[model samples]
Target: MQFQIENIPIQEVKLDFAKDVRLFVKREDLIHPFVSGNKFRKLTYNLAEANKEKQDTLLTFGGAYSNHIAAVAAAGKLHGFKTIGIIRGEELVRKVDSNPTLCFAVENGMQLKFVTRENYRKKTSEEFLTQLTEEFGRFYTVPEGGTNDLAVKGCAEIITENEKDFDTICCAVGTGGTISGICNGAYSHQQILGFPALKGDFLQKEISQYTSKENWQLMNDYHFGGYGKVSEELVTFINQFKQQTGIPLDPIYTGKMLFGIIDLIKNGHFAKQNRILAIHTGGLQGIEGMNQKLQRKGQKTII
Candidate 1:
C-alpha cells in the first residue's frame, strides 16, 4: 500500500471508569515521521500555496525544540524548497548540537537564524517581517506553529464521514489552529473540547478568529504549567500510558490531553454513554529535547 497522509484510523482507548463512554483517539501521529499530526495538517495547504506562488524558499519561526521547525525543515527537503528557521532563544544557536529539533532542522538543510525571545515576539509585526524580507529576500513565510488560513483549511479535513459518529471531539490545543479546524469540520451537534498545553484564557480569542462556530470550549486546567512545562506526574503518566495502550504520546501535547480526558471522565465531565474522539496531534520528535531538559533538572526522563 502506498503511504498517504489522510484517512488515519481511530484507536479505541480502554478506560475502566469510562466504560459507559466510548473513548477513541484519531491516530494523527501516524501521519508522518516528522510532519505528523497537526503539523502535517497545518502544512499541507501552506506548502501548496507556496508552490503555487513559485516560491523557492520557505521561512518560518519556532523555538529550539519546536515540532513545527522540524516539520518545516523536513517538508522543505521532501518538497524541494529551501527552508529558513527563525528560531527563538538566540542562545540556541550555540547549543544546536544539544537540541534535537534544531539539529534535525539543520541536518535537513534548513538555514537556522537565531533571535532573542523578545525579538521573536515581533515575528508577526510588519516591521519585523520587513526586516526578515530584507534579510532573506522573497520567501513564503509560515507563522510560528503553522496556524494560518491555509493551515486551518487543511486541519478542517481532520473530521470526515468516518468521525461523524463521535459525539464529542477532543485534541491538544497549542496555537488553537487545529481545534479551530476541528470546530469547522465537526458536526453541528458535536462538542469540541480543547485541552490546552499552556495555561491561559487567551487562546479562546485566537481560536475565534478562524471559525465562527461556538461548538468548542477549552479545558484550562490540564496544562501542567505553561508551554514546554511538565511535571514528574505527567512523565509517569505518559510512560504508563504507553505501556498500557502501546501508544507513545509526546509529553507536551497528546499526553496531557489524554491525562485530562481521563481525569475529566472520573469527575463526570461527560454524560453517560457519550462518545469521544481525541486527536493525537504529534510532537513525538520533541521528546528527545524534552528529555534533555528533564535530565538537566535531575528529573525522571520520559521513556
Candidate 2:
C-alpha cells in the first residue's frame, strides 16, 4: 500500500489581539477527509510497516467517538487491509447506529468488538492481547490514539522548512505522539507548546518518552473539565472562531487549544511581535456525537 501527503498550508488567524502577536494555524485537518490531520500522520508509517510485514489485518483500540478508530477504518478500506476496532464500553455495541464515529468506521468495513471499560483497560496487557490474537488470528496492532515510535516519526514530518520561522509551535496533546514529533522536527529556536485535551500531569512523562527535546511545555489549564468534556463557553468560542476565521475546530482538541492560545494572547502571555503556529489536528468527526450530548443536556452546540 502506498500513500501520498502534500505540504499542509499554514493560514494566518487574523484577530484584534493578534496584531502584535501574530497567530497562524497549520491546517493539518485538510490532509484527508476521514484520515485527516495527525491521524494521517500517525498512520502513515504504521500502515507502511504493516504492509512491510505482509499483514492483511489491522487491529486497534478506541472509544465510541474516537478519531483514531474512524481514521484506521477509513485507511484500511483505502489500502485494502481488514480493520478491527476493540471499542471501549460494551454498552456502545447496541448504540453504534446512533454514534456518528462508530457508524462511519463500520461503513468503512471495520469489525467492531465492544468490551467493558475494565476489559478495555487491559487492552495493552499481554494476556488480553493473547486472547485477541487467539480470537482474531494474527494482526498488526495499533495502540490507542495511534501513538507509537513510527507514529511519532510520521508526525515529525508535520513540521518542515516552511515552518522554521515560527517562534512557537502549538498542537493539542492526546497520546503525545503528535507533539513529540513536532518537538523532534522543530528548530532549536522554536518553542513547542502542548495544550492537553485531558487533564493530567502524566502527559509530561508520556511525551518525554518520545522526545528528549527541552523546547516544549504543556498548558494544562485548557482542558475545560477533562477528556471528551466541553462547556458552553468553549462551544461559543468554537462557533465564533469559525465565523471569524472560516476554520472549524473540534471541541475535543483544536477548539480548546485555540481557545487557550487566544486567551493567552489577550492576557499578554506571548511576547510582543511573536509568531505562533498552532496545529489544527482534526477531530471534527466527533462533533456530531458531541452535539448529540449537548442537545440532550439542553446546551448550545457547535455550529
Candidate 3:
C-alpha cells in the first residue's frame, strides 16, 4: 500500500525581528495528528518496505516520553501492522497510565516492553536484536528516532522546488535524519543549519553517514541543557510564540530550534536580506507529558 502524505504548507512567521530577514515555517506537523512531521516522513517508505517484505509487525525503541514511540504505534494501527515498543526505563511500565505518550501508544494497540536503560543502549547491537527477534517472532525494526536510509529518503522530499529560493534551511536535529535529508535535497546555494536538541558531538558524524552534502552545519549552543530538558524561559517563549504566531511548538525540538533561529537573527548571525525556512518537525504530542512534569516541579507549563 502506498503511504499518502499531505502537501506540507509553508507559512511566513510574522514576528518582530530583523527587518532584512524573512522567516517562514513548513507545517509538517499538519500531516497527521499522531503520525505527523518528520515521523510521518520517516515512516513513509519504511511502511511500504514492510508491506513489501510481508512483515506483519513493526518493532522500535524509545524513552518514556518518546514521540517516535507514539508515532510508530499510530502508524502501525493505521497501516494494519502489530507494533512493539521497547521502551527504556523499566519503572515506566507501571506509569503508562499517567504518561500521555505511552498511554496513547497502548490505546493505539501497541505492545509495550520496558527495559533497563543499559539494555536500551544496546538496541542497535546484533545480540540485542537477535534476542528481540527470538522473543517477538518476526518484526520489521525501525531504529530509535525513526531514522534510517529510507527515513532520510522520505525526509529529502521535505525540500521541494518551492523551497529552492530560500537562502538557509533550519531544523531541529535528533538522530540527524531530518537535517541530513534536507541537506541532500537543498539547492547548492542554500545553507542548512541544524539545532540539535541534545548536547553531542556525535550528531555531526551521524548526519554525515546519511548525506555527503557539505552545505550543512550544526548549532550546538541552544540545547538548553540537553535532551528532554527545558526551562521556564523556553516555556515562556513557546507560549508567547504561539499567542503571537498561532503556531504551537513542543518544548523538545521545534521550540528550541526556533528559539535559536530568532536569537541568531537578533545577534546579526545571518546576512542581510537572508530568507530562512525552518522545518517544523512536530512533537506536539509530547506537550501534555511535559506539562505534567512541569506541574510536578512547580514550573510553568506549555500553553
Models, CA RMSD each? 1.3, 1.3, 1.5
lDDT tens digits, residue span 1-303, model 1: 223655788999888766679899999889888888999899989999999999999999998889999999999998999999999898877898878898899999999999999999999999999999999899999999999999999999999999989999999999999999999999878999999999878898999999999999899998998898999999999999999888999999999999999899898999988999999998999899899999999999999
Candidate 2 has which clashing residue pairs, if any?
none
Report the Cα lDDT for candidate 3.
0.94
Report lDDT (CA) for all predictions.
0.92, 0.94, 0.94
lDDT of 3 by residue, 1-303 (tens): 333355568999985757989999998898888898999999999999999999999999999899999999999999899999999999998999999999999999999999999999999999999999999999999999999999999999999988988999999999999998999988999999999999979998899999999999999999999999999999999999999999999999999999999999999999988999999999999999999999999999999
Off by over 4 Å in 3: 1-6
After superposition, which runs of candidate 2 have C-alpha atoms over 4 Å from their true positions? 1-4
* TM-score for each predicted model, relative to the true structure: 0.97, 0.98, 0.98
Supply the TM-score for candidate 2.
Answer: 0.98
User: Candidate 3: lDDT of 202?
Assistant: 96
Q: In candidate 1, which residue pairs clash?
A: none
